[model samples]
Target: MIEVRGLTKTFGPTKAVDDLTFTVKPGIVTGFLGPNGAGKSTTMRMILGLDRPTSGTALIDGQAYHDLKQPLRTVGALLDAKWVHPNRSAKAHLQWMAASNGIPSSRVDEVLRLVGLTEVAGKKAGGFSLGMSQRLGLAGALLGDPKVLLFDEPVNGLDPEGIVWIRKFMQRLAAEGRTVLVSSHLLSEMALTAEHLVVIGRGRLISDTTVKEFVDRSSESTVRVRSPQLDALRSVLTSHGLTVREDGHAASAAAALVVLDSTTDAIGQIAGSNGIVLHELASQQGSLEDAFMKLTGDDVQYHAAGVEEVMGGAL
Candidate 1:
């Protein structure tokens, strides 16, 4: 497991990461989340000891990454896939890493196969696509057969197939009892991959929780009520202390009302007594991204317009 206790870092006057503390357990995927420039890259660098912490530490198993006898065998990370040389073959790059860490040369082929990079092992990295580079990076991380893994933007530029493959591979790695932590800006992708989440915003830890608990607690749960007699139901619901509002989006389709109150039971009781025939009365579920936006959006370290539209457009 990776234990980050009060891990902090600063660049000159800027505090990149502030008093962040969380535990990343094995056998599950923990998503590291934040808006752009929220210090995610800096924190990952600190974990790998590429950047020094201003205070506290990030420990792997019980010791810092820099203090390990064989850091690769203890924890492997892909902080930036772009760090690789463009001139070198993928296999050669892994071979170099293996040689540096005293890992067996044969493990190079093993990791390449593990990440499905065997076909391109002989190709130069410069000619490889973003998806291929990501695969190569993942291969390097597994070269040591480490118990811990950290990935920063593992699926940033992947195609649909590549994205799907990476998600399953991360899950499969976690199932094999390895600690896997991946950082991503794709909420929909995270909703599928992560079992737990560590949400960060403006360089501070906002939430650390199980995916289900986080969504259930932070999401705004509202009961949906649809009926042909929307007016009667709305009047009856408002009279019974259940604040009701027209679901304008749902209204044209089925004359629906969305209850603003949390008393589903009371709404049911009132609807039954008022002789209201309910077409639909169910909770409107919210996504993890929706909850995150509700919580950290105001203070989102990075704000970009049309990004959501672009992501939506891709769908």
Candidate 2:
């Protein structure tokens, strides 16, 4: 397991990470998430001992990263796939890393095969495509066969096939009872890949919970109703104390009413009782993207201008 407590880091006047605390237990994939400039990278750097924390501690199992013997065997990380020497061959790269940690040269070939890079083992790192480079990085991370693994944007340069492969690979690792923590900006993939989430913003801890709970808690579900008399239904719903808004994005010619914090049963009962016609009534559960925006909306450090402002009355 990975544990971080009171983890804080600062660079000059800006605090990159606040007093954050969270645990990543084994046998599960935990997502590390935050908006740009939210200090997620900083925290990960501290966890791997790449950067010294201004205060607090990051531990793998019960020992600090620096204190672990054969550190790579205890924890393996792929923070930057491009960190390898440009002239080094893929096999040469892993060979050196293994040598440093007293790992045998045979393990290098094992991991290269594991990452499907055996064909390119003799090729220079600089000649590999971004996707191939990512594979090489994964090969290195698995060189030690560590119990804990950390990956940052592992799918950045991967194709659709590679993305699916890596996702299943991480899940398989977790199934084998290894601890896996992945940081990525792909919310859709995170929704599918991670079982739990550690979300942060502005260098502060925002949430640490299961994926289902996080989405359910952060976003409100709405019922979408379409009818010829949308306005009339809106009025009835309003009279019943339901918050209703026009669903401008609906496909039908007649507008729909998006009733917040409502259910099909209640809406259907009211519509039936009032003799109102209903064409469609469906529950719209909030997605991971919706919940992420809702919880971190205010915490975002940068805001892009709205379309109106950008267009400036041109239309």
Candidate 3:
């Protein structure tokens, strides 16, 4: 397990991370989420001992990363897939890392195969595409078969196929009882990949909860109803103290109402009791992207107001 207790980091007068605390349990994939410049990278650096924390602790299995005898054997990370030396071949790079960490050279070939990079293992790092670099970085991370893994934007430049592969790979890692923590901006993919979430904004913890709980808490679920007797159904629903609004799709001829804070069964029961002819009644829960926006609206450090207005309405 990975534990971060009151972790804080400061650079000059700016506080990058502030008194943040969370735990990453094993056998599950935990998503670390935040807006741009939200100190996620800084916190990860602190956890790996690449950056000094202003206060508090970041521990892996009750020991600091720096104190580990063979750090790669305990924790593997792909913070920057492009951080490798440009002059070295992919195979040579992993060979050097393994040599330093006392990992067998044979493990390098195994990891290369694991990441599907064996065919290009002889290619220079600088010549690899972003997706190939990401795969190589993953190969290095798996060289030691560590019990814990941290991936930062592992899908940054990946194609759809690569994205699917990485998602399945992370799931497999967690299934093997390894602690997996990932940080990414793709909320939709994160929704499918992560079981738990640790969301932060402006260097502070906003929420640390399961994905289901986070979505349920952040946005109101709405019950959508379409009926020929929309007027009567609306009155009945309103009389029951439920706030109902015409759905956007309910134009001049459309008869649909979206009931807030309601369930499908309750809506159906009310319509049946009132003899309302319902064509459809469905429960629509908010998406993960919607929930993230609602929770971190104010915490976002930057915004293009005009662009957001245009895109938001269009979306």
Candidate 4:
């Protein structure tokens, strides 16, 4: 397991990470999430001992990273796929890593084949495409067959098939009782990949929970009601003290009404009692993207102006 307790880091006048604490348990994939400039990279670097923490601790199985004997055999990480030497062959890269950690040289071939890089194992790292480089990086991380793994954007340049493969690979590793922590900007992929989430914002912990709990707690569920008596339905809903709004996604002359914080049963009953003709009524569950944006809206460091803003209200 990975445990971070009150972990903090600062650079000059800026505090990159602040009192961040979380635990990643074995047999599950934990996602590390934060907006850009939210100190996720800094925290990961601190955990790996690449950067000294300003205060507090990041421990892998109760020991600091530097104190581990043959750290790679215990904790494997692929923070950057391009960390390898451009001139070195993929085989050479894993061989050197294996050698430094007292890992058997033959294990390099095993990992290469595991990551499907056996055919190009002899090629220069610089010549490989982004997807191939990512595979090579994954291979290096698996050279020791470590019990703990950390990956940052592992599917960054992968195609659809490669992405699915990586997702399943991580899941399989976790099933074998390894502690896996992945950081990625793709919320959709994270939703499918990570079983748990450790979310941070503005250098502070925002949420640490299962994906379902996070979405359920942070996002509002709504019921979409489509009806020919849209106006009557909206009035009835409002009169009943429910928040109603137009469903912008509806394309019909009678726009669909989205009833916030409501259920289909309640909406259907209301429409029925009011003699409103309903066409459709469906409950919409809050998605991961919805929850993420709602929770991290303020913590985002850079905000892109909307079209109206860009046009100075002209639109």
Whole-model Cα lDDT of every candidate shown, in order: 0.87, 0.93, 0.94, 0.94
Q: What is the lDDT of residue 19 in candidate 1?
A: 95
Compared with the true structure, the alpha-carbon lDDT of candidate 3 equals 0.94
Write down the worst ten-residue block by lDDT for model 4. Answer: 249-258
**How does each model score on TM-score?**
0.92, 0.97, 0.95, 0.97
Off by over 4 Å in 2: 252-254, 311-313
Better structure of 1 and 2 per TM-score: 2
Q: What lDDT is reached at residue 24 by model 2?
A: 97
lDDT of 3 by residue, 147-188 (tens): 999999999889999999999999999999999999999999
**For candidate 2, lDDT tens digit of each residue in 1-315?**
999999999899999899999999999999999999999888888989999999999999998889988998999998899989999999999999999999999999999999999998999999988899889989888999999999999998999999999999999999999999999999999999999999999999999999999999998899999998877888999999999988879766767889999899999999999989999999999989999999999989999988888999675
Clash count list over all predictions: 0, 0, 0, 0
How large an RMSD does model 4 have?
Answer: 1.3
- Total colliding residue pairs, candidate 4: 0
Best by lDDT: 3
Give the per-residue lDDT of model 1 (tens digit) for 181-293. 99998989999999999888778998999988888888877888777788888888777677677787863767778887465676777888888877777877779888878
Give the clashing pairs for model 2.
Answer: none
